[model samples]
Target: MSLAQPLAELLEAADRPLEDARAMPPGVYTNPEFLSHEIETIFSKEWICVGRSSRLAKTGDYLTYDLAGQPVVVLRGKDGQLRAFSNVCLHRMSTLVEGCGNKRVLVCPYHAWTYDLDGRLRGAPFMTQTTGFCKENYALPPIRCEEWLGWIYITLDKDRPGVAAALGPLEKLIAPYEMENYVECFRETHVWDTNWKVLAENFMESYHLPVCHAATVGGHSRLEEMECPPGLEAFNYHWITKEASLPMGNAHPDNRRLEGRWRKTTALITLYPSHLITLTPGYFWYLSLHPKGTGQVSIVFGGGLSPEFMADPRAEEYVATLKGLLDEVNAEDRGCTEKVFRGLSADAARAGHLSYLERPIHDFMRYIAERTGGYRRAFAVAAE
Candidate 1:
């Protein structure tokens, strides 16, 4: 069988371009209409990494999260099965749960409508005699959900393809990790005043690592030695980096000792729309991007590892180090992206092209265009 055209072109271009051949379009980051379309077409149609699967390890455990402004609840039933439902209460359309917890039944704080762990409507405080108030039909609407590599992924579309099918080549790349064995050690949510696409693109390529994150994460590896395999159409890549040979300037006095501990790191991962996963030597981190508006994005960072790692005293210290490194890198990214957003909004440029160094982002944009049937329209707008 012959390779697809996009895939073939991507592979051929991967080795040739040292810089972006095309400018990244401004609409991807600054246009409200484009942002709305992305939320509806990109986010709702694809599988999104939510939280860690271990968050629902026990029966009755539940967590509430917002996905592109939609409130969702993930729960583990008494039978030890995982399920997801819209967090809106059936009676008054109020949120049934506010946060994560173990509950025998999810009772709406507004009108006291109750639901079982399976999302079946079990009780209502009032309307016992009301006609057409059957509990059978009042169950919370379910969202399609699946667990992969210790992460919980959900899709708003009930009929959309399963996570395994959607991930395609990425699943095979991450298969060796056995991520299900890891336990979550840390999770954090931060709001950024930038478009979600900016965050996705920033994470997809390491071209800026040398310039932007030079102090913390950037100095830890040599960018020149990094190798990106052929094929933009492939879902993932193998990023191999030699460990730090020397100490990074003491950004933190306490972490100065960890300079040359790790010998090498291999991040075998993929960028599926707005989600990103990175496997470090000691642990794994997943970032989920949920766009709030044209200029705002909600980011959730989740970390996973074995229970022993979580319980270790040194692990806490390591987490602190990691968090500090991430804070610096993320702040740098946010500063640049926010500035870019502002510039794009002020200029009103219709489009831009992608650089050769940004093949992953280009591939993603292509995928989105094909899926939404917007490639032709986007190109036409650019031409004008």
Candidate 2:
């Protein structure tokens, strides 16, 4: 099928320089056909982040997620290794697991077909009498899984590059924060009424923080103090320096890794398709998004404190404070992004010139365009 007109136009806009860029067109968010295209091209091939490795701290701990149309389960096995397997029963094709939990063995609820933690078929009831039924032939298929800087990522495309190699430079850029050492205090999932891209763009820019987040982090954000630099091949980033609205937003008194300005600065990073991270000196949080059709998004929202804060005497209080503040901030973001989606569906919705603060969104649009087969036409705008 040919590319849709609205999405084609959006790709053209995405190629422009920061001074001339515009908001993406509305149809890209509202079109079911376009979402399907994205699922096939981007979600299926990219290294999609499931969550932080800290959540699965023990053997047999597992979490389930649906990528595109495939059911997936990421689990820690008896050998202290993490693995991803298809969460489908080989017998009747029923889903093996639903959510996150500890499972000694994967037991299919449909007919009690059991599988070992390593994806081997351990048992299958009532199949002995059947002719030509060999348990040895069955096993949960393994998916491509890897750990990069404490975060777990999985990909359906076996040939895709490993996360560590793809994000090597990112590790060096964030080395001082020691991201892997941050202890995850909480992880929650929510379904919101907005296109996934809308939510992603909201997190990519702090332009709306002073207004949309007025009741929370608004007062602490200074537009002029924000910095937007050119993005790299794998990711985009921006920096915001200010007196943190929450104490945990700054470095702990015990922190020795960061000095002077680094203590008060926050890095807002977007890792290709949809991993958004806000890393501060004392804490870090992230949102991993998946589309739930044209009008909704599935979000894996999680965060926690740095090693210094985790080792502090008031760690419990700090965790409570950080969780409470993040909850409020998420509520504000949901409200703003949902409103943008609603407006996009209106007849009068038209693309508008972008602010310098929204440079990352422009970069994100270009990434999507490239993945969805619009790259040839999209990059032409850049050359012009």
Candidate 3:
């Protein structure tokens, strides 16, 4: 119940006006106890995005995720609906599935208790003679799952509001992009040696682009032209209007929904807690984060092309180009975030004032403060 010195400072700093706001204190990232508090207060109750629905295209395709410490599985059922359930077996508590693939029925490797696509217990060998044991009495516990704008989100808190209700304003802001029509090209998971917030903050601001990504995306970012407006209750965002570094970063030749500025602009959005998205005219990529203790983060990284680009005759080349660029950008981000985490543990570490370009980071710090410290902070609507 005792607060670390730096964490206490973080709560104070997060309340400052934007012009006077400083970077969050080191304890925000280094305190193990606070991380546990965050898992319970934020990650457990929020709708955490797993990935795009397109990834589970077939009837039996399923993907597994570790939500905080709990194992979960999201899959496409035989009735053509997406459902989420506890990955642990009803009997003996063994994990039902590992990674992702097509499986007609989920069978526990430990006891061979089989479950149908709908999570009904269909078979259990050697349990037929067990007294008072009925297959109808057992099933995998269902988790709340919903699809919002093509993204699949799951939550352990069944009482939490639906994703669309929480992100309705965001949908209008990005309606022109038709996010649901984006075709997913790839998805991969990785664990990086850094606090989850460090990576989430890194994606929310563009100030580090020119220096951290100098070899790749930084040069094209046009820092002077970037817009860091106030954030909304559900998310924070910034925008940049510049020429696309890769051809696919621009609007596809057939795209007519976007106007002149929208065609060249990119939106960097961080949905409160841990969903970060980079939406462009022709392509999009996102990072979904979950803390793995105080020093590690599990990331669900994925990207794909817009409908226009997917329909292009040279779609394969566009896919290759976009994927290669994103891979390089991710590598650059990894190095920078890992280094920042190391610095936070040093004895001489100190928080510094945030720049105008780092507005999203400041907003993010306030969000953390509000959640973990139970502060009732007001949110200003973000500019489109």
Candidate number achieving the greatest lDDT relative to the actual structure: 3
- What's the best-to-worst order under lDDT? 3, 2, 1
Where model 2 places Cα greater than 4 Å from the true spot, the runs are: 1-3, 376-384
lDDT of each: 0.66, 0.89, 0.91
1 or 3, which is superior by TM-score? 3
- Report the C-alpha lDDT of model 3 over 1-384, residue by residue, as the tens digit: 346665678789988999998999888888888898899899989999999999999999999998977899999999999999999998899999998899999989998899999999999999869998999999899999999999999999989999999899889888888989999999999999999999999999989998999999888888888998888778989889867898888898799999888899999999989999999999999999999988999999999999988998999999999899999999999999999999997879888999999999988888888888866678655456
lDDT of 2 at 81: 97
- The TM-score of predicted model 1 comes to 0.81
For residues 1-384, write the lDDT of model 2, one tens digit per residue: 234775677667767877898888888888888899999999999999999898998999999989988999999999999999999999999999988999999999999999999999999888889999999999999988899889999999989988888787778888888898998899989999999999999999999988999999999977899988777667888889968888889999989999989899899999988999999999999999999998999999999999988998999999999999999999999998899999999999998998888988888888887887557423222100
Q: What RMSD value applies to candidate 3?
A: 1.2
lDDT of 1 by residue, 236-298 (tens): 454657454222211123322123422244463555676676665445666788888878888
Root-mean-square deviation per candidate: 7.8, 2.7, 1.2
Better of 1 and 3 by lDDT: 3
Candidate No. with top TM-score: 3
Sort the candidates on TM-score, descending order. 3, 2, 1
